[model samples]
Target: MAKKWFLAANKKQTDGNRMEAPQRINASDGINTSASLETLPHVLFADDDANMREYVSCLLKTQYRVTVVQNGIMALELAKTTRPDLILSDIIMPGMDGIQLLQALRQDPRTHDIPLILLSIRASEASKIDSFDAGADDYLVKPFTPPELLARIKAHITLKRTRNQAYQAIKSSEELLQSVFNGVPSSIAVYKTCYAADNSIDDFEMFLLNDLMCQSLNRPKHDIIGKRYRELFPTASKLDVLDLFKEVVYTGQSTSFERWYETNGKNRCLRFKANKLHDLLIVIADDMTAEKQLQIKNEQMKAKQLEMEARQQREIFRVTLRTQEEERRRISENLHNGLGQMLFSIKLNLDTIDLSDSLFSTEENRKKLKNAELLLANCIRESRRISHELMPSILEDFGLEAAIENICSQLTGPCNFVAEIEPIVPPADQEIQLAVYRIVQELALNIVKHSQATEASIKIYDSNEGFINATVSDNGIGFDIQKEDNNATGLLTIKHRVKMLRGNIHCSSQIGIGTAIKISLPKTIDTY
Candidate 1:
């Protein structure tokens, strides 16, 4: 009088309102599944009771391709060949039960990781522990509801699929990494430290050498691998590479350096990077011979260019000193010729104009006195002109603008000098101001002396580009700046002054057209 038990099938109802039959499996023929069920995961079930097997097959067939066997012997035999996604078996049977099947599955390499669930009529804690000890992934007591059984089955199947996917991904990644490590252009090697009897590092034995390493060293892998570093390169100590390897191993700090390596009678620059990996040292090297050669060539060119600039500057300095000496000689000549004669004549006239002399008539004496007074006035004007030429008094009193204006007014030649000077805040350094004034003075005077122009103009302004700009131009026949600038001492003097102020000068002139000289000085003193 045992109760008959059956669970309703979960398969979709057909047009005739009947459930589909559960799929059957054979060891030789495999599962006899429909085309629609071909993609479902395979499930293997083992139990001695016919009712339990029938119920489970019907319950799981809708979601899985179900295969039912009589006991663990059949289940284990089929699992070895077919490799189902999951297995469910009843624990208690006549012989070859679920516990024994699980042990066998766990021991087999092919079935070790398959998800298995055990079922038992006896719900004792001892039975559950025994099932788990036998390597069952999950345990279910008899008379469990269909929902609970299906949920457990779904979770285990999903977990197994996820784990398989992860394993495949990791395997593919390792393959890709190995391919890159072998194929990279840089040379790579790994070395394990060999210790002497005293426990101090004696040498490093080659643990790994990539293909590039062998090619770079011009040695085959068989010759390089497992060879000690000192044995491979007797001159490693001279190169300092072996010492760097030891430092990285002892201090656990990475080191990178470049060295000249001699190979096949050719010297090449190679850059090496060494890092410690536990008890091993990893080194990567790159051929930098070409880059290093190019860098050295550039440095040589730069040095040559700097030397030429220095020579030019020295020449300018020599010319500047010579110009100052000529200027002083000219001033001395002017004083001796112009002022000295006038003063001597005035002294003679004063000596004759003594009021005690009776031979001197009133009108005659008045005239001689007037002539002496005119001579004295001429000497005073000559002295003042020389003082102004040395350093303009107006410049010191009124800054750069007023100084330029005074020079414009004093221009005595046929050229009409016009000034357009902006009122700017004077620079903190008086030397800079003096340099600017001299530049303007040289340009204006050169226009009058060389350019036979009727009109000349000068402009000075503070530019928005952070510079003080000055320009001088004339409406007269001009000369080739390249040809004349080097020859003209006046222009040379202007250039020297401009250079001292760290300023730029541009002179543009055509044969028939007028000439314009423009100079720009940085407002900030340190810009040069």
Candidate 2:
């Protein structure tokens, strides 16, 4: 029946004068094939029936560049040589059957991807299944419509072209990726995880290496690619970095580490980061030696600068202390030589006079003697007060707390004073003790003279953290801290002294509220 239908198709094509030869059809066939027809997709047709071949060629010639063969063997040879976009074959052939041709084409690497359509008179499910099992892309019965054949050929060719285009794009992308990987600034390497029998990642094999990575390893790509990590780097086992790589693969997490790496006898700091990509591990390495060395040099320079500043400060403090001692010595000398001699002379003259026998015990003369004695005593008391004011001798005789207490007792004006001082254990060094005393003295004087406060208090104690803390507060009218003039001369002097002793001072005040001054000094000063 199929042969009768083919004969009828051939008769109709002959009546229309469209019958073609049962051989290859191309531009060189002298059929006036246009250049556009040559660019059309090529289709290979195989069938033993001559009328069917002519009819199929007449149907497809207008749309495709058709090549007709007498048998599957000829079709396979033509497909292999021409590499047609699609193949159409009849199952029952003389030499190689359509199924056998499909298998052969699928086995050959050159023609494996070409689309194949199997045509057979047997429309049973078994035949169709056999054709598909042989890698036939499509299957059709012998008596099919021309539209169906044309549509099938067009669809297969379109799909094949799409696949080819996609393959070309993928290849281009791979080449671009390889170029970028090699051109990257940092070192990079890829490894494929090699698993053990227990499904655990035991080791890694070198998969890909970039240019910088090759240079860093001091080896070429061919020498390292596909080599086991341990075989290439035996020392890595001792470092146990393989566990890190395994962790990345098993956990699918990224990790990073930094270490000092020595290569070619030079030590360098290298930072490594590993990322998991499916079963592959991508490790990126960066050289941090320059940055680390710069940091170390900066730290050393900063330390030296700090030391130099400390020495300069110590020298300034020493010079200032020496000058203060000299001034005190001069004041002491004046008081002792000039004032002491005058007071001594006055006492000697008074002792030389006998008060009981003076002026024969007359009331006027005795009153006069009493008045002169009171005047002489007043002068002596005033001279001693002046000397004590210059340098508190009580501070030397008694301890710091007692000296401060004596100072508090001397607050004679309207404002009251209180002292909360702790006994210095082991006693502070003389310089610190004096500095504390002077700071308290200056702050106290400032409060009395300027603060117009009715009440004031001074506190001194050990912070128990190697510091001596002092706070002086007053319930007086405060002033704006932002004003420069508000920082009085006495406060400036206190600040200078505190700085020399390596101390910190904080002054807080408000317009209506009182003022508070707190000072902290280190218990031990590092002169060097």
Best by the lDDT measure: 1
TM-score of each: 0.58, 0.45
Candidate 1 wrongly placed segments (more than 4 Å)? 1-186, 193-205, 210-238, 243-256, 264-266, 275-279, 286-298, 350-357, 361-369, 398-401, 422-433, 484-486, 524-528
lDDT of each: 0.83, 0.82
Clashing pairs in 2: none
- Measured by TM-score, how close is model 1 to the native structure? 0.58
- Candidate 2, which ten residues in sequence have the lowest lDDT sum? 17-26
Clashing pairs in 1: none
**lDDT per residue as tens, model 1, 132-170:** 887889999876677789899999999999999999998
Top TM-score prediction, candidate number: 1
Residue 80 in candidate 1 has what lDDT?
A: 98
